[model samples]
Target: MDTALQTKPCRFGDKNTSDIVICLKNREGIPKRFYSHSSVLINKSKYFANRLSHPGSNNCIDIYCSEVNYDHHVNLLRLLDLPTDSILDSFDSVKSAVGILQLAVFFQCEEIACCCIQYLEAVPWEDKEEELILKAVSKLGPKAMPILARIQPVDLAATKDVFISAVRIATSIAGPCPPFGNELKTSAQEQVEFMLGEDEDAPLVTADEEVKSVLRMGLSQIYSSFEKELSSLLLEPDLVSERAEEKILHSLCDLEWMCNILGKMDLMKDFVSNWAESSSNVLGVVENNKLDSFMWGLKIKLIEITAKVLEAVGYGNVILPTPIRLTLLKTWLPYIRKMKPLLDSKGSQETGFPYKMSEDLCQSIEGAMVTLVLALPSNDQADILADWMGAEQVRYPDLSEAFEVWCFRTKSAKRRLVEGLDGAGNATVSL
Candidate 1:
C-alpha cells in the first residue's frame, strides 16, 4: 500500500512538481493559465498527448487554448482534477453540466465527455435555459454529440424563430377572429409570415390532435388557476392591492389571448356566462358575506371580466338573458349614478368610489348593456330601463339619476324617430 496516498490526497496537477503550464483565453483575447502534469493530460486527451509530447530536457511544457469559454475551461480543469469517471459524481446544476459538456468536448476528454453527455440526456432543460443549451451544443456541433450523429445550427435558429413568431402571434392584440387568423389575409403580414416560413397558410382545422389536447389542457389549467385566484382574492379583506389586481387581470388576459388564437370565441363566452351563473348561484353566500370589503372588491373584479368579455365579443354576439343582463347592469348602476354628471353630459372626466369599478370598465359595461337595449324594441327597451330603476324600492338615488340621464336622451331621440315615421306614413298615404 502507498502510505503517502492513503494519508493525504494527491495534488498531481497543482503540485510544485507540475511539468507543464496551460494558458487558456476567452473571446476577448484574455488568457488564463493553469499548472498541468504531462501524465494526466496525456492519458486523458489524445490531442494533448500528441501536442505536449516534447517540451525540453528541463521537463516543462506550455499549452494555450483560445477556443474555449474561460469559465467552461476552468470547470473542465476542475473535472480533470478528479478521477475521470468521478467528474459527474456531484451534480451542481444543469448550467454547470452543460458548461462541462462544452469543455469536455473541446479538450477531447473522452471519459468525462461521456458523463457530460449522459448528464444532459438524463436531466431536463429548463425553458429559460433551453436556448442557451442549444446554442452551446450548436457551438460544439458534432463534437458534443456522442449519442447523436449530426445537428444543424440553422435548423435550431429557424425552429427558435418559429417558436417566437408563434408566441407573438398568439399574444398580439387580436382582430375580431383573433390570433393568427384573418390578419394573414393582409399582404404585408402575409409576406412577413411567408418570409419567416410560419405556417399561417395551414388551416387551424388541420391542427394535430396532440396539439389540440395540449392546448385544451392549458386552457383548463388557466381557468383552474383563475378560480383559485378568485378564492385567494376573496380571502383578502381589502383587495386594494392594485398590483395584485393588475397581475390577476393580465393572467386572465393571457388566457383570453390563447382563446383568441384557437378561434375559441365560444370558450371565451362560456367562461363569462359560467362565471355569471356561478355568481348568481353563490348569491346567498355573497349576501351573507361578512367581509364587505372583499365582497365589494370581488364584485368589481367579476364585473370587470364580464364587461370586457361582453364588450370584446360585441353586444349582438352574446345573449344576455334578463337575469344575467340585470345582474351586470345593477353591478354598475351605482357607479353610473355616481358618474351621472359626467356620463349624462358625455364628459371626458371620470368618477371614483371606494366600492366602484374603474371608470373605464364601468363605462364599458354600461355601454355594452346600453347598446344591447337600444337594439331592442322600444317597449322592451323601456321595460328594461324600468327594471333598472325598480330593481329595489330603496333610495337608489344613483339608479334614479342614471335612468334620468338615459331617459331624457333616449326619449328625444325616440320622439324624433316617431316624427320621422309619422311623416313618412303621411307621405305614403298621399302617394
Candidate 2:
C-alpha cells in the first residue's frame, strides 16, 4: 500500500511501530495502554515532556482520567499524534471541543488549546453550550478572551448608538411602510425587546437616561406624524380613500408598537400624557369622518390603545393634571361605548368582521373607566355617571360601583355638612 493510503497514519497505538508505552489510568477499569514515540509525546505535550524527563530513563508515562473523561482523553491522545492540519477534524461538536480544551489546558499543550479556542470563537453555541463554554473558559487565563468576546459587555456608547439607529428605523415618520420596511421594522422592534427583556435573564442593556431619551424622541416623532395625518383627514372631504386609510392606520400601528416597548421600560407615563393631550383631537377626527365599514378595524385599534392608556391612568401608573385626565376619559369613554355595539352588530353579519373586539379588553376598559370615574371629584363623578345612566348601552360599562358610591355620598351630604359645622364649633371652643 502507498504511504498516503495507510489507515494507521499516526501509527499511534500500533505496538509494532511504537517505542514507549503510554498508560491511560481510568478511575474504575483496568489501565489501558497505547504505543507512542518518546519524541512525539515530548514534542506534542509539555505535561508529558516534564514527566518523561526524569534522571533515569523510563519507557512509560501514565495519564489518569475519570470514566466520563476517558473517551476525551483517548481522543486527545490520538490527536497529539495527528498531523497539525488534521487535528481539528477529530473534534466536531462544541461539547467535544470544550472537553478537549479542558484537557489541553491541563496538559499545557498550547497548540491544541489554541485550536479549540479558534473553533469555539467561530462557531454558534446553543444556550446550554454557551453556559458550559463560559464556565469552562472562565477558569482559563487571558488566553480564553477570544471565546468570551461574543458575550462580553459592549461599550455603552456603541450600544446606545445601535439602539438609537434601530429606533429611528422602527419609528420612522415616513409614509406607509416601504419595500421590506415592515420586516426590517419588525426585526428592529424584536431586537429592542430582546435588549430590554426581563423574562428569562436580566436585560442585556439597561434603559438608562440616554436610552430613554432616544425612545422619547422616537415616540414624539411618530405621534407628530400621526396627529398631522389625522388633521389632514379631518380637512379632507368625507370620501374614503384606501391610501388615506393606510396612512392613518400605519401611524396607529406604530403607536401601538411603541406602547408595548414603553410598557416594558416603565415609560408609559410619556405615552399616556401624549395620548391624553391628543385624545379630543383623535376622537374628533373619527366622529367627523364617515368611514366605510372596513374602517371598523381602525376603531378597534383605537380602543386597544385607549384601553392601555386607561389602565395606566386608572391604576395611577401615569398621573396627569385633572383636566387632562377628565378630558381623556370623556373623549374615549363615549367612543368606546359607541363603537362596542356597532362592532358587535357588524361582527354578527354573515361576512363577519375581521377585527372582533377582545372581550378581555372590553372588561379591562370598563373596569378602568369605573376606577377612573370614582377617582374624580364628586362633581365630575356625578357628570360621568349621569351620562352613563342616560346612554343607550349602559349595560356594558356597568358603573354600578361608582353609582352606588355616588348615591351614598349624596344621601349623607346634609348629615356630613351638619357634622362638619359641629366639629368646627368644637374646635373653635378648644382653641
Q: Rate the local accuracy (lDDT) of all candidates.
A: 0.55, 0.82
TM-scores, all models, native as reference: 0.48, 0.81
lDDT string, candidate 1, 193-296, tens digits: 34434365432222355444444554555566555665565565555667656655654555554444444324454555645555543343434445333334
* Separate clash counts for every candidate: 0, 0
Q: Please identify model 2 stretches exceeding 4 Å from their true place.
A: 1-16, 21-34, 50-71, 83-93, 155-157, 173-180, 199-209, 228-247, 264-266, 350-354, 421-431
lDDT score of model 1? 0.55
Tens digit per residue, CA lDDT, model 2, 171-239: 873433678777888788788877776787556566789778888988998898888887887565544
Among the numbered candidates, top lDDT falls to 2
Backbone clash pairs for candidate 1 read none
Best by the TM-score measure? 2
